[model samples]
Target: MPNEIPSRQELIDRAAELVPLLQKNALWGEENRRLHEENLDALTESGLLNLRVPTRYGGYESDMRTVVDVIAELGRGDGSTAWVMSVFAISTWMAGLFPDEVQDEIFAKPGVRVSGILSPTATAVPAEGGVLLNGKWSFNSGVLHSSWNTNAAVLLTPEGPQPVMVAIPVADLEIVDDWHTAGLRASGSVTTVARDLFVPEARVLPMGPVLQGQHRSQANADSPVFRAPFMATACATISAPAVGLARAAKESFFERLPGRKITYTTYENQAEAPVTHLQVAEAVTRIDEAEFHARRAAGLVDANAAAGKPWTLEERARVRLDLGSVCRRAKEAVDILNDASGGSSVFTTVPIQRIERDVQTLNLHAILHPNTNFELYGRVACGLEPNTLYV
Candidate 1:
C-alpha cells in the first residue's frame, strides 16, 4: 500500500477498490482510442488525480514508490490509464518548481490538471517585461482534461540562443487535435499551438541554473523537493505502468488457461501442462525482477532527497540504468506470458493482446528508449560526459 511506505496507504486502498471498474472501463479507452470522461472521474475519485499535488495544495505529496505501486495497480488493468496518469500527474509536480506566480496561476483553482510537452518546438522573442512565445508542442498528453500546459521553448536573443521551458495556460492556445497513435491512445496526446502569446516575466523561469540545482520557488529554496532532477525520477514513473501492464497480461493468461486447449497438443487445459508452468513462472519472475529494480532506484531517490543532497551524476546515471533495465524486464515478462497464452492470446476478447500492444508502444517512448539510456550509462561508468542533459 502507498501509506505503508513514504505515501499514505489509504489512497492506494481506495484506488484498489476501483480496479475492477477500471478493468472494465479499459475497453472504452481502447475502443475509442481516447480517455473517456468516466475514466477521468474514476481516477479523480480514487485519489490518483491528486497524488502528485503538493501537500500545501490539498494533496498527498507521495513518494515515488507509493506513486509506483498506485500506478502499477492502475496499469495492471489498463495501460492507457496508467500511462496518462504517469505523465500527467508527475508533470503536476514538475509545475511546482516554477516561480510562485506561475505555480499559483496553475494550481490555485480546484479541479485543475496540468499537461506538459517537453519537446523544444517553439521560439521566444524577448519583450519589455516578458517574452513573446510562439510554437507548437507535440504529444500533449492529458490535454483534453488539462487546464494548463507547459512546453519547452528556445529563447533567441541578439546576444545568443538559450533554452527555457515556458508554462502556458491552455486558454492562451488552440488545440491541434492530432493524437493518432497505436498504443496509449487514450492519452489524447494532441498537439497545442500558441502564436505570439505575450507571457509575463513572472510566468517564465530561466533554464540553465535551475536544472543544475538552483530554483526560484520560495517554498523550494531550502527544500529538497525541487532539488530532485526530473530526468532521474521521470523514468520511474513511466516504467511503473509497463510493470503493471505485464502483471495484467500474466493474470489474463492464467484466467483463460483452464478454458482453452493447446492447438497441437492433446492438452485440454493449458494450466495442467508442465510447459505452461514453466512459461508462467518465467513471466512472473521477469515482472517481479523489474519491480525490484524499480524499487531500488526509487528508494535511493527518496533517501537522497530526504537528506537534502542533490543526487550526483553517478547516482543519477545509475537510476537511468535501473529504469532502462526495468522496462526491458517488463516487456520480457509480457512476451513470455503472451507466448504461453497460445495463438488465441491476440483475440479481441483476450487482454493479452492489449497488454502486448501497450507494452510495445510504451517501450518506444523517447524517455525509455533502451539503447540511448544504456549507452549514456555506459559512457558515464567509463568517465565520459553525459550523452545528453537528461541523464
Candidate 2:
C-alpha cells in the first residue's frame, strides 16, 4: 500500500497498461486453473486490489462507476482476471459491513485480499465466545490468492435459522480444488469447506440489514462509497466485466480482420464484404447497448449511495433488470463477433474462442441471467413481491 492514494483515472490508466500482461497469462492461468502470480503482483502493485477499501485504510475508496470502469479495463485484457478482481473488489466492500473492530483488524494490514460467497450454506450454532460454523460453499472466486474468506452461515436461534455473515481467515478454511469448467478457468472459483470452525462474535454481521443499506464500519460511515445499498449495487459489480469481455471480443475481431478472407466468397477480404459490414454494425450496437445498461446501473447505484438512503424495491429491481440486459446483450454481441470472425476464430489459439466461452459462462450466472431477472422484475412491476431474498 502507498501513503498517497491514486486518483480514479490513475487507477483506470494503470489497469489499461496491464491488459497485455493479463492476456499473456490467460493461457497459463487456464492451464493451472488459477491466476498466475505475476497477474496478482500486477494487481497489487497497481493498487487495483484495494479499489473498494476505505481511504483511511490505504484504499482508493472509489465510486461504483470507477470500480466498474477499472474492472472493465481488466476485462478487456482477460475475462478470468477481470472476474476474479471484480469478486475480490466487491468482497472488500462487503468487509465494510462488519463491525468497526473487525474492519480495523482486516484492513489495518496491507495486501489484504478477501474472497467470499453470499449464500447461507452453512450452520452456525452458539458457542462460548462465538459460534461453531460448519458448511461448504462453492463458487468462491479468487479463493486461492485470498487472505480471508467472508461467507454466510445460518444462525441457530430459538426462533429459527437466521442468516449472518462471517469473515474467516483463509488459513482456517479448507480449499477444495473442484473448479473444473470450460470457461473462466483462471478464476479458481472452487469449493471452500469449514468444519467445526469457531468464529468470534465480533466477526459476525447481520446480513438482512446490510443488504438494506446498514453497515458498521465507523471509519467509512461518512463515505458514500461505503454507504451504498449492497443488493442494489451487487449486480452492477459482476455485470461490468461482461461488458468489458464484449469489448475485448470486438477488439479481437477487428484486429484479425485485415488479412482474413471469406473462403470461397467473391470478396477477397472479410472487411470488404457488405455482409461483414452488417455484422460489425450489429455487434457494435449490441456491445454499446450492453455498456449503456451497465453504466446506467452503476450510475444509479452511485447516486443512491451518495444520497445515503435506502433504495426502494422498485429501484433495486430495476438494477437487476438493467444487469440482465447487460448480460444478455453482451453475450449476444460476443456471439455475433465470434460468428463473423469465421471458422478460424473457433480455434483454441484464437482469442475470440475464449472470449465467447467466457461470455457464455457469465450469462449463465443465476443472478445475472436474463430470464430470471426479467421474471423477478416483472413480479415486482406487477405489484407482487419478489420471490428471491437478496432483493
Candidate 3:
C-alpha cells in the first residue's frame, strides 16, 4: 500500500493527541536521563516519527510548515521528547539526501529513527573501499534510541580538509552515558565515539554540496520537501521546539493560576493582581511572537521549496535570525512565566521549571544562540558576507 500524505492539520492533531501520554512519561524520562519507552512508542505509533522520511518509503515527506507544527505540538507535551523528535526529523530529511540505495536500507524498517550532529568533530582517512572514521561527537540527541546516526566528519582530500556527512549504524559506535545536564535531560544526548570505524563511500556525502541544495540523491532531486537549503530547513525546524516550550510554559502557568494566591501578599487570588496580569500579558505576547517567527521561518522554507527559488544572502541570514529570535523570545516567555509561578513552581511536579530550563538550554546552543544569529543577520543586512557557511 502507498503511503498517504496527511494534511497539515491531521498531523498536528495526531501530535496534539499524544500530549497527555508524553506528559505522563516526562518525569520518567527526566529521572532516567532518557526518554521512556512509552513516549517513544507513542511517537512511533502516531506516525510523527515518519514526518520527514521519504514518501517512497511509507513516510509522510511533510513540508517544513507541517514539520514545525507537528514538532511544536510535541513540544507542548514534553521538551525532551520534542527536542529528540526535532533531531530525528532533521536527520531523516538528511537521510533523504543520500543515494536511493541508502534510503532503501534506512527506511526499510518501520519507524526508523535517525539521530545526528552537525559539527565536524570526527576525522575520516581514506581506506580500501571507503574511509576509516575516528573521533567522538558529543550532544548526539536520540542516539540511544536511534538505529542510525548521521554524523559530520572531516575527510582528508588533496584539495584540503573536506567535510562530509556519514551515516553509521548506532551499534557500530561506542556510546558514552555521560548526558548529565540541567535541561532536556530526557533527550539522552550522549557522546558517541567512532574508533577507526569503516564507512562505505556510498553512505558518505560531501557537506558543501548538501548545504547548497546540491545533493547526490537523484531520486529525491525533484522532491519539494527536500528542495530548500539544509540550514534553512534545520533552523526552521529547530525553532519550532522553542515555540512549543513557550506554549508549554503558558499552559503550565494557567493551569495553576486560578486557585493560586500571591504568597506573602494580601491578594487571595494571584490572578487578580495587576502584576500578575502584566506578567501573563507579557509572557503570552512573547509566546505569540515566538510562534510568529517560527511560522515565518517555516513559510520561507516551504515557499522557496515549492517555487524552487534561489536564496539571497539576506534571506539565508533571516532564517538564522528567526532561529535566534524564537529561542530568545521563547526563553524570555518561559522565564517570565516560571518566575511568576513562585517558589512552589520549583517542585519536581511542576512543568514550568523544566520548560524554563529547556528553553535556556536551547538559547545557549551555538547555532541557535540569539546574539550570534542577530549579529549574522545584521552583518548580512549591512552588506557584509555571513561569517559562517551554515547559514
Candidate 4:
C-alpha cells in the first residue's frame, strides 16, 4: 500500500488489471462456494479492499463514483467477486460511521475485510458495558473471509425495540456452511449465528440516525466521502455489478459469435442473421442503459457528498429507482444475450451461463428487486410517505 491516496483513475486501473485473475478464479470460487484465496490476496495487494476505509487508517476514502467504477471493472471479470467486493465497500463505509475509537479498532488491521447485512434479524439486550447480542443473520456475504461483521439487530431498550448496527468480530460467531445457490455461489454468503455475544457500546451504532446521514463518528463527520446518506451510497455501489455483469454477457457473446452457427437453421453464420443482429442490438442497448443509470446514481451520491447537501425524499427514492433500473436493464441485457447463446452456452466452461445466473440473482435481491424499487419510487413521487425507512 502507498502512503499517499491514489487517484480515482488509478484505483480503477488497478481493478481493471485484476480482471483476468478474478476471471481465472471464478470457477474455483464457484466450485468451493467462496472467493478463492488467491483472489483475496490479489484484492489485498491491489489496495481495493480499503476503498471505503477512513484516510487516517491508510485507506483511500474514495468517493462513490470511484467506488462504482472499480466495482464495475471487477464485475466485468466475475460477478461473485464484484458482489463480494461491493458488500465489503458498503460494510467498511458503515464501519467508518461508528465512533472514532471504534473506527480505530476496526481499521487498525492491515487489509481489513468486513461483511454485513441490513436486515435486523438479531436481538440485543442491555449488558454491562454494551449489549449482549444473540440471533442468526443469513445471507452474510463474504463472512468466511472477513474479520468483522457489521450486523443489524433489534435492541431491547426501555423505550421499546430499536434497530441498531453492531460491529462484532467474526470469531465470535458460529459459521454455518449453507450457501448453496444457483447464482452468486462464490459469494460465501452463509448464515452466522451469534449466541450471547457481547458487543461493546462503542461498537453498536444506532441505525435510525445513521440512515438519515446523522452518523456518530466525529472524526469522519467533515469528510465528504462519508457525508452522503447510507442507503443512497449503498444503492449506488451495489448497482455497479449489474452493469458489469451485462457487459460480461456482451463480451462472452461477441467472443463466441464468430464461430457459432444457428443450429438446425439455414443460417451458416449466426452473426450475419438478422435475428442475431436484433438480439445483439437489444442487449447492447440495455447494457448501455444500465451503465447510464449506474453512473447517474453514483453521480447523485458523489455530488451530494461533495456539496454536503441534505437528500430530499424524492432524491432518495430516485436513487432506489436508479438501482432497480440498473438491475432490470442489466438482467434484460443478459437474458437477451443468454437466449442467443444456445445450448453450448450451458456448459460450466462458458462464462455467459454464470453471468446470467449472477444477474438473475442480483435482480432477485430484496433491496435490488426491480418491482419493489419501482413501487417505492412511484409511491414517493405520488406524494405519499415512503413505506420503508431503508430509503
Alpha carbon lDDT of each predicted model: 0.78, 0.89, 0.93, 0.94
Per-residue accuracy of model 2 over 229-331 as CA lDDT, tens digit each: 7777678899888988999999999999998899988778888899889999999999999989888999999998887777889989998999899999999
Residue pairs clashing, model 4: none
Q: Is candidate 3 or candidate 4 better by lDDT?
A: 4
lDDT of 2 at 274: 91
Sort by lDDT, best first: what order? 4, 3, 2, 1
lDDT of 1: 0.78
Which wins on TM-score, candidate 1 or candidate 3?
3
Candidate 4 residue-wise lDDT, 1-391, digit = tens = 5569899899999999999998898999899999999999999999999899888888889988899999999999999999999999999999999999998888888899999989999999999999999999999999999999999999998999999999999999999999999999999999999999999999999999888888899999899988888899999999999988998899989999997899999998998899999999999999999999999999999998889888999999999999999999999999999999999999999999999999999999999999999999999999999999999
Off by over 4 Å in 2: 1-3
Against the hidden true structure, what lDDT does model 3 obtain? 0.93
RMSD of model 4 against the true structure: 1.1
Q: What is the lDDT of residue 262 in candidate 3?
A: 92
Candidate 3 structure quality by residue, lDDT tens digits, 1-391: 8778889999999999999988888888899999999999988898889899888888888999999999999999999999999999999999999988888888889898999999999999989899999999999999999999999999997788998999999999999999999999999999999999999999999999888887888889998888888999899999988999999999999999998999888999998999999999999999999999999999999998999999888889999999999999999999999999989988988999999889999999999999999999999999888899798
**TM-score, candidate number 2:** 0.97
For every model shown, what is its TM-score relative to the native structure? 0.94, 0.97, 0.99, 0.99
Off by over 4 Å in 3: none
Tens digits of per-residue lDDT, candidate 1, 1-391, equal 3332234577667667776876787777777767878778888766677777765676666777787888888887788888888877667877777887678778897557788876679999999999999888888888777887767788998979887877788888988978777778777788888899998877776767655656567865655555667766676777788878888888887788777888878987777889888888888899888898788877876787788777788888888888787788889998888888777666767788888888888778787766777888999999999978776
